[model samples]
Target chain A: MMQEIRQQTDANAVHRDLTRLPLDTPAQQAEFDAALQANLPREAAVRRQYGMDRRTFLKLMGASLAVAGFGASCTARPPEEKIIPYVQVPEVMVPGRPLFFASTMVLGGVATGVVIETHQGRPTRLDGNAEHPASLGGSSPYLQGAILELYNPERSTTVRRNGAPASWDDFRAELAGLSSANNANIRILTETVTSPTLAAQLVALVEMFPNARLVQYDPVGRDNVRAGGSWLLIRKSTPITVLTKPKSSFPWMRISSLVCRVACATRGTLWPATPCAKMQTRPA
Target chain B: MNQLFRPAANTIARLSLLASLLAGVVILALLLVNDQSPYTRASVGIAIEQPVRFSHKLHSDQLNIECLYCHATAEQSSYGGIPDTHTCMSCHSQIATYSTLLEPVRTSYATGERLVWEKVHDLAEHVYFNHSIHVQAGFACETCHGRVDQMVVAWQAQNMTMDWCLECHWEPEEYIRPVEEVYTFGYEAPEDQVELGMQLVAFHEIDVDRLDSCSICHR
Candidate 1:
């Protein structure tokens, strides 16, 4: 029955245009007749499986509905609901009104600034932050969908060590033990450090240990763009994207170059150039 | 063959038919009574218990504290907000510091746990009501709430059914008063209430035609 509906839907799509135009021609009439004829047999088979005529089915349905209605009317009262008021409400928070906070979400080294709407304390919705250079009141589908990730059930909710559940203190103690060893090769693997504070911390960590290194790795990294000689240069604290015209006439190269230019221009100081490179090459 | 029925049988049949009709009428009357009863409505003079028994009579009547002092959002937001525990402690901390009755309020303030207050005038989820709009339109708080200053415990005074809402929506001029009288507990409507209300409605630019539209409240 499901397969029959799907076939009918597919057939309907093919004849969708035919509906707008009049079936004036004999050929058009014949095509419509053919589509209808194809569906009639399956529909007849489904009706036969039910083994009840329209009148009999209606009578049965009416009788059952009357019984259900009688049963439902016996219970009149709805379940009681309670309203819990905050002990010490925040100065800014009003019970019914939603509050918005400016934040950033990063995916594949690209950061988008967003304003999150929170009810009481839980984040409910996300929109583009109007003031941020990365978004400028416009958001991509990725930024809009980032709110779902906060409540994603499959997301890792605890620290793990060697594929087993571990506490943060345990991880910290182990890290301290590892760092105490003078010749330890501590490699911190992260996905795109965009925040200035995080980059500073990474730099400080690398400086602390002579052999320590930080590697920013994304599955869909812009290695091709870097190889294509599209560099985002920071001159006088402002990012300038000098799009060096593609040496080759390849379509992908041109598209990549365009994306690089847009990413660099809109991204601005979101991904700082000096600190990012310094953190990467300092240990090396 | 003897007759299958006697004259007495015909009377019995007619009497049975009349009894069935009477039974139907009695059942319908019972249903109507149930529909209008306070037990079914679960509101209108039903004072739901709260974690802390806060008295509006003492606060708003004796002390003469404004309704907006605690329910501050009523003038601005859709909800007549239940005051935070902090709002209660602001005064209770100094005045009734060690009162046994205020133990819940103190516990909530100290432990940072919320006090679950049962709603007295709960509306259906589908109905969209904005207290700010009504208050701003010179609809007195007492008009629907009914002398809250006199009640020891807060109870819903109005049924707040769709029909009750339509009574005002159809003829708003019968109820609307001056804006200043909105928060007043026992505001008496002037003799020329309809006349003043008509002018106020025009002054507020309220479109009477749009009031009865389904989306006005349902949405």
Candidate 2:
């Protein structure tokens, strides 16, 4: 295995003409031959003394079998390409034929309701995934068509190291550095998280790194909630709310699409329906 | 220095020099090819192999067991689904109760453990999955799901994604609902799409005009 791996490595590593050797001079060949001869087994050397007689015997025995089996495979050239085309790829392959699967799913938002679909897998057309309780079998198109956003290909691939490839060790080292910093000085920001376990872990990390701090920023802030969540500690507590509009990790605008109106905090407030209107072009 | 010590030291130094030279040459060649020094994390951590060997075709074709008996909730639940240990226990407890094929399951029950069945379909984090709706709406557990009774150890037969899913929903009748013959492991008409589309349009009062809107799903 080691020899095979070395051969592969040499094959891959040497891209130039290898037949013309830089080191295999006549003297070097003679030296290699002498070294090889010195290492040959004594039994093999004795067998060589018997010379062509034994070879002739083995050659006669091998010829009969080789002649019999060679007939079928002699002229076979491998086809240019081999394709195991699916024997029956479903006649549903017809262009006009549309097949649908009714699977239930959730529509993410302030409401975050369940929905059903009368969709193909793409939601080329939509109906809710009706059986789920939240949608109550009736669905709006927003929840029905969300499947399109899932496959948009623009999702972030979790790249790190300022766009350079990075090792998990590098990530761990950076995180360790951040944790080692003063909790009050280090800021870890996130949207309102639902998992209790995650919340507990965050609290533990916060206590461990007293100098480390957290900053929560919502793109679309619920007027009163954002005001309160932000001011609680501009330097400490994780500011989170349902409609302060969590920062979604979706690469396209679709990530934020799931965030609903801040009806709880905005009922009587002056903020517009779409919060994008509220963000300043540049921070003052 | 003595002759013995000097000769040994010279060989050691020469071998080290050769090894270092080869290492440097390899590293330099990689650098020229723009090869990264560090490899990336490209996959997840947890992967477990299944215990039993089961064939879908044998159960589905030979015994004629329905897909839903094992799957149970392909159309009615959020999980297209995996039968709970009890469900497996229900039948195996009586039929084929003593077989080694069912022995591992017995071990799980004795230990109060869940047999780690490897999941075949892995959906994107963004999409939702449900089974009850499909089952209740007159779809056989076999249609979009593929045959399960035929499988001993369940394997994913279809690519489950948003596009493949939506295409199934747009006109379900083609892939679904022959009514009398619910389990379809065989061929059907290719034009069933338009036929099913028209049937769905009539069956459910969906306005075809607004079907393609992103808000139908994105929200």
Candidate 3:
């Protein structure tokens, strides 16, 4: 019914276009205003509820008053020189000085540990985990920019359902439905997760679904690394053998009279934090 | 007569409009907070103030209390964890009962709150400096911490930059990895790293071909 009403047009739609014309000059605009003023008495029954009562109408009047009073005794006075009295400076504040503290960040997804530098309350930058698996102890350039991601104003705050704000209860109900439908046969599709407890939880969840199959879908869309490893060893346990430095850092590796790969490989053995290279025989 | 009546009515209407606008502005100012902070630092830096003027001289020299006695966790965690109010209260709870220095500690304890300690020494945001790894590896609290046992008010000793960290690491024997000779305090190395590396190689039968690689440190 509301849609149908919106589709219909008012009898005054034709005359409304006349008032909508953008008069460029103040004189023309004033004439238009005068014409509007002339019609006000006719529309007074409906116009009293809005228009003059609208803040926009008041603003229009205020602007016009400012323009009208531009000269004569109404000439603008110079803005008040607001001498904001200074507040007492706290003894602790030294304007240019910043203090740093060491903080830890959990590595998400494929990355290893990262140490963060916190200045005041703001996380300023990421350093290598220095002692964690995956990254070994070194940080990649990609990991360095995580502080921006942490403080990004545009990051999503809450989950949404369709276009509506979803409540925790509503989400739980959806999950419950999914659980029942699977009926002791559920599959949690994930990559090569090395977490033992998580695998156990997945098995427990599968017990709920009658025939749920946990399909392994590598998010990288590659499966060469997915050929099941023996229970004795995990793939992640092996350190990166050919830890190649970023090309910019080691251009000599590509074009040198003396090839630099062996130096890079040997350097990894000596230094833990630089470009740690592994045997080239291993697939990167 | 018409002109005189029109101007009077217009003036009254316009005055009413201005009054309404002024009222709206006041309402908005009440609704919003002024976001601009005069100081970029936190709470005008008041939150970062030291609880007491803890002297390294009186504790480290006069009483011979080890630097680690006060900042006990420096050798264990990423944070040389600042002693909580309770740690201060352990002694101050009785020893300095009447002193003005212990007043804040007592007040914090009575209120069931923690001390908000102002840190003096700081490191860079991009560097992941470890306390335990360095401590366990036999680096003194002073090497990177810069002679805190001698400081009156523990201030940052090292500039703690990438170059400084790398400089120390580059010559591991001088500043790092060589624990036996660095600390004058006679802190012994738990395991000789070079000897351990050798023994592990021999026992595990790990050839140079199968050892921890560069990915261990620089990811």
Candidate 4:
């Protein structure tokens, strides 16, 4: 049996060498001949030794056939599954048909509008919402990955204090105690605020604590580019740039427009050029 | 050689050999029978009980209510959606308001809890059966369901095995009818069924060659 296996491996090596050989040149033909000569003698020697008698071979084959026959009968019937119907079906919902809802996903301070496709109340897919000013029927990998994040099992579900699980009531009581201490130093750390409701809340929180400080920080913020004099304007957290600098000789070839186009291409929030109207525009 | 076995022992050995052969044959036959039996398939004539004893015979056969009235999405959706509690109360609120038979339905509507009806005809998970495509192809409800209007307690009428589905799919021209007769129960094919089915197959634009493809049903 060992001799037969060795002979089989030798034959396989020869077959592999033959397939790998490019017979287009005389050198390759010579190499192929060398490989064949090296393996042929060992194969012949191994073949001369007998592996198993016919009777033993027949017995093993018969045993395998019986085992296979028994294995075939072992498959059980499929388990039962239930189909639970809704108590009150939504007006617009039809079973097996998907409904798309317009929503927004925020990442690193930028919000992109997306259309989420839901099947029977479970969101199954996501795409860019065309009607929204921020999306304009375009999407990014980060926007698509939001679905994975939404369904991620490792996502934080409850309040935690210093890596240990805590409750909201306990946190609220601690916060009340700290505020009532009169001279407590409170520092609020948050991402860049864009939503009007959140911005108003943060302002009210500071007003109530008098000495409390609010710090807005974004890891991927374009502060470096702004400091480097890149003509990028920030107005109410929306990145807007002057498309046509009137005083410049070449208004069309302005670097600011090019930078703005590249920066805001995925954002799809290019404001209409009205010479910086209303709100004060700052570099950072 | 030493007379260790009696003369009658030869007859016993031969009789035992024959009995063993008979037993093997009997076991094989039983296995074959069990494979095709309703106990294994769990289908055909097994009426599963539901929370409410809703009778198809009364609603469909006696009252002559159309099948589409309850399963409205059957023509447009893959699923023949089960009627919600609101659909039941649509009629029961005025008709069977005080009946004890509809107490579960009333309680479900009042509390906004779903009625846990037992599923009768459950298909294999891999088989992606669509009702709308079959309905649009002009296959009558009775073609596969087999006189559901006659069923007092709903039961699976056909085995619905892969071979049973392939029988219609293999030769769609032999089964299809006019679109108007899709919801008509107890519909009988005409004498010129093959000829009419051929026309309907073309009218419905069903690709016969693609019907038998693995992805068509499996996917």
The most accurate candidate by TM-score is 1
- Comparing 1 and 3 by TM-score, which wins? 1
Place model 2 in a CAPRI quality band: incorrect
The best candidate by DockQ is 1
Question: Model 3 reaches what TM-score against the true structure?
Answer: 0.31
lDDT score, residue A241, model 1? 46
> What lDDT tens digits, residue by residue, belong to model 4 across residues B1-219?
124356998999999999979978976886777666776676678887888889999999999998988888899899988988888899888997999989999999999988888878888888998899899878888888889999899988888888889999999988898999887887878999999888889888889999999999998
Instruction: Name model 4 segments beyond 4 Å from true.
Output: A1-75, A154-187, A217-284, B1-36
Task: Give per-residue lDDT, candidate 3, residue A4.
Answer: 65
- Stretches > 4 Å off in candidate 1: A1-71, A155-170, A183-187, A206-215, A230-284, B1-36
DockQ of 1: 0.28
lDDT tens per residue, model 3, A200-241: 988886676758788765444323322332223564333323
**Model 4 residue pairs with clashes:** none
Query: What tens-digit string does per-residue lDDT give for candidate 1 at B120-195?
Result: 8878889999998999998889888999999888888998878899999988888898899898877778899989
In the range A1-284, model 2's lDDT, one tens digit per residue, is 99999987765444222212232367854543343345434533654576433345688768867655543333232222211212122433321224566553322112333432322233465453345333333444455456576557674456468777677899878878776455436577865443577668888877877776666445553445555656876743323223223335432332223343432223222122223333322222
How do the residues A186-279 of candidate 1 rate in per-residue lDDT, one tens digit apiece?
8999987767888999999898788998999977665555544444532222233433333234325432333343433434223322222222
- List the lowest-lDDT window of 10 residues for candidate 2 chain B: B36-45
DockQ of 3: 0.02
